[model samples]
Target: MAKSEDFPGKPRNAPTWMSGVGRAPAELPEPNLRVSVKEMLAQQQVNEPAAKQAVADTKVENSQAKVSGKVLETQAPNGVIAEISTTNIRVSPFQPRLSFNETAIEDLANSIASVGLAKPITIRPIGDGIYELVGGERRWRAHKLLGRETITSYVREMDDALAQILALTDNEGQEALTEYERGKSYAKILDSGGERSIRALGRRLGVNHSIVSRCLLLMDLSNEVKAILDTNPGLIGGKRAKDFIEFSNEEPELLLQAVTAMRDEQWTQEHALRWLAKEIASRDQQKTPSKFTDKEISGIGKVRVDGKKVELRCEKTVDAKRLAEHFEAFLKTIDRSLIISE
Candidate 1:
């Protein structure tokens, strides 16, 4: 059965929202049928209890273009030098220089005051109307000292690897790098695959392939040797590090001895090279295999076989399982015909 209102033209079968039974549907909150997970997270983040609980949960912040390049570059774009507000620019966390020279920066500031900045610093936008420094920290400091509101900067969009390399190379071009800093930077570039190969890295660094190779060798120095050099920032150079690494590869113990000698005597590079030569000769004499037994050295263990006999002397401290595995590996390498099986 149907019922009609006797007032102004109204139907009893009118839609629920249109009916005057209660408030209109549009007045109530809409259903979240099409709400996304991100929206749910935002809602949770807004809620006090849910937000607090989320702190303990393992949360992964997945971002795609929030920290993008093309849009950031569009502000200044290629070959465009712009004057960005000083306060808006942030220092780069990836800057290679560990400590700034106060005296040198002061001198630079005085010069800049007299002649003005010769060049603009390089930077890249990192969203939110903020920019990150790519290079020229010294110049940035000078401008900051002068209480200038804004300084000239060249803006570019780059990835972490490219940003790091450019920051490193810019400083390198203007100033020298410590051996540790240079080697580590070179290693980072090589490992990051930013330049792809040694030759490519060399080209960017304005060095020959051999020089690039030697710089990387500095990283192979033992921790003990590095610790000694750390105490004196410029105690040794790249060439010396090359000789040290080669000597260490031949005799690791000799490296420790050489480090002690260098620190105690304050030996120059020439003196150090002479010491390395002597150490290498000494190691060669000791490591020469004897007729009675041949000694095999490895990371795991040192073995001496008694004239092709079953007698074996193992010196390295190793677990029983590891020793057994090493023995099995050695056995596998032997000619199969030499084995007698049932």
Candidate 2:
């Protein structure tokens, strides 16, 4: 038997599809007749055996596209002026919003001029001749500087979010990318996704959350400081890198100056930090008096007693006789007539 809610006014024998359609069946099968999962598996094995599958799916989805194009031309896109692509292919518009050191860029430009672009940049076509850079903007810039007519590129159609992720991953895979580049990539992940949480980004990238967070923090530092960090691998340990990030916002200029001094003057982290503290204190104008008084001996000597306990101190580097003469002169100034001991 079935309730009215279960079957409505239709017959219990009515087909499931007929229940919703115009026609109603006269009767329905008992619910107890449904097959169990174990029975289904047994029947399936008898009909067609299951096979093991590979752990990772290497095949790219068909909906995605990949194409090659020669470096037709390159142009400075947006405020990022420097290089051009060979072909005006349509690409995703998600530009990597980060800055690079002019010095580094110049080095890259020189390398490109000398060796040519070693790798092709990836891009996804948006529409028409306009293409969005997926990866290899740096390479593109280099090639543009070289005035190369044609270069290799991979073009695909990807969603905006996926394109950004792909760009980030692609950049990260390159061994040549500097620490600053890695930091910029992490920053891009935060900017693209509303969740600027480093932990979440690290989980997505299959890396430890702290690493991602530290890299992102590095990006907040000025380029001059970042350049120093890049040059001197030992300026900050893993622990200190995190500390630097915490201070980036509060004392960016000081941090930059300190980093510059550390690199230029070959100062240790402790020295740089001490100088920074002193500068900060001076800015507050909280000065203190000197601890030493004029009466204190300026040199080393022994103590003696006449009327009062007196100590002999010397300023010049001389023998005991010269020191004695200095003491006699001092006594004459005090009394003009006093027995002196040799």
Q: State the displacement of the C-alpha of residue 303, model 1, in Å, after optimal TM-score superposition.
A: 35
Model 1 has an lDDT value of 0.69
Off by over 4 Å in 1: 1-79, 227-233, 250-267, 271-342
State how far residue 306 of model 2 sits from its true place (Å). 33
- Number of clashes in every candidate structure? 0, 23
Clashes of 1: 0
Clashing pairs in 1: none
TM-score of each candidate?
0.52, 0.44
- Position 123, candidate 2: lDDT: 68
Q: What Cα-based lDDT does every candidate model obtain?
A: 0.69, 0.57
In the range 75-138, model 2's lDDT, one tens digit per residue, is 2121111123555643334444344455666688798778756665676655555667887776
Best by lDDT: 1
